[model samples]
Target: MLLQIKRLSSSYGRVRALNGVELNIEEGELVALVGANGAGKSTLMRAISGVQPTNGGGIWFDGADITKVSASKRVRLGISQVPEGRQVFSEMTVEDNLLLGAFTRPRLEIDEDIEKNYVLFPVLKERREQLAGTLSGGEQQMLAIGRALMARPKLMLLDEPSMGLSPLLVDQTFQTIQKLAESGMTIFLVEQNAYVALSIATRGYVMEGGRTVLEGTGQELLDDERVKKAYLGV
Candidate 1:
């Protein structure tokens, strides 16, 4: 497995957010995690990325235990997270924001990486000198994904890529995600839109009340009666 979580639990002070969550992602696999708002999906993503503190259980990446790893170190170890919100550096130019993602890399290789981002997100190249804050929501989302790719991560954690997008932009964003997965990037996606998320997933898990309540191939979850009733609006 490229990533593994065993009984992982996290908390926000007195409130428990994750309850023994277990999941795995294999190399080059596109795994989707779907749940409703407040279902602890984002917390689980944070825990896996080593930003949120864990009270119990473990996280293993590429066969190494990294539950105690710092967030920066996790990034260096090839785990990159594109958080729930776009969270772009509003004051910085588009090129500068992309440069920041490669902070851990050698300076000599940074420019090459930046060019790669431009190729992947041509709009960012066009707006290289523009401040990130001025871009439309969809453009910012593209920039966010481009920034994360600059890290050259082995596993990409995407939280709510479709949040706040127009229906047309949502469709475009997911098309990009599907292409990324098809090109062999391993991804762990957390999303509230069950239908969109599951439709592109190789496999999927359902989170409920701070726990993973179901796991199956994408089609399996889509075809499941309970999933249909509760999430698919069948």
Candidate 2:
């Protein structure tokens, strides 16, 4: 497995956010986690990225234990996160933001990686000199994904990629995600949009009350009666 979460639990001050959450992602698989608001989906993503403190259980990546690893070290270990809000550097130019994602790399290697991202997101190249804040929401979302890609992560943790997008933009965003997966990037996606998440997922898990309540192939979850009623609105 590329990633593993064993009975993981996390909290925000007094309230628990994740409780005994078990998940695994194999290499090159596109895995999706679907849940409702406050289902602790983002918290789990945070825990996996080593940004959130886990009160219990373990996080293992590529056969090593990294439950106590710092977030930056985790990034060096090939994990990167694109947070829910496209939290790009508003005042910085688009190229600057992409440049920052390669902070750990050698200076000579950064430019080449940036060029790779521009190919993935040609619009970002067009806006290379423009301030990131000036882009439209869809463009900003693309920028967010591109920024994370700049890290050259083996596993990308995406939190709500479809959030706040129009129906058209959502389709486009998921298409981009699908393409990334098709290119063999291991992706762990957390989304409130169950249908969209499952549609492109190779396998999926359902989170509720901070626990994983279901697991199956993406189509199986989509066909599941319980999933249909609670998440898919079937």
Candidate 3:
């Protein structure tokens, strides 16, 4: 396994957010965690990324235990997260925001990585000198993903890449994720759009009220009657 979460549990004061959630993802696999609001999907991503502290659990990545690792160190260890909101610096240029993602690396590598990101996101290339705050919602989301990629991560955690977008933009975002997966990027996606998510994911888990209630191949989940009734609305 490239990533594993064993009996993960977390709480926000008296509110228990995650209840012994368990999950696993293989290298280069695209996995999705789908759930409704307040299902603890974002909390799970935060725990894996080492931002939100866990009460009790183990997070193993690339065969090493990172449960207690610092968030910055985790990024250096090849774990990067594109947070739920497209948290781009509005005043900063697109290139500058991307450069921030490579802060842990040497200065020389940062330039190289920025060029690579530009190639991956041609729109960003055109807006390289433009302020990130000026981009459209979908474009900003793309920039967020691009910024995360700048870190050269072995495992990328994404929180709701499709949130707050038009139908057309949503389709484009899913296509971009599929392209990334085809290029051998390992991804753990937290999304509310179950249908689109499962379509691109290799495997998936369903969360309800801070617990993982279902696990299976993406196709299996898509075909599941329960999943259809609740999430897919089929």
| Candidate 2, superposed: residue stretches over 4 Å from native | none
lDDT of 2: 0.93
Q: Give per-model CA RMSD.
A: 0.8, 0.8, 0.9
Clash-forming residue pairs, model 2: none
Candidate 3 regions exceeding 4 Å error are: none
Instruction: Tell me model 1's lDDT, rounded to 2 decimals.
Output: 0.92
Model 1 agreement with the true structure over 1-234: per-residue lDDT tens digits: 999999988889989999989898999999999988898999998888888999999999999999999999999999988898989998999999999988888899899999888888899999999999999999999999988888989999999999999999999999999999998999999988899999999999999988899999999999999999989899
Q: What would the TM-scores of all predictions be?
A: 0.98, 0.98, 0.98
**Per-residue lDDT of candidate 2, residues 9-126 (tens digit):** 9989989999999999999999999988999999998888888999999999999999999999999999999999878998999999998888866799898989888888899999
**Comparing 1 and 2 on lDDT, the stronger one:** 2
lDDT of 3: 0.92
**Residues 147-204, model 3: lDDT tens digits:** 9998999999989998899999999988988999999999999999999999889999
Q: Per-prediction count of colliding residue pairs?
A: 0, 0, 0
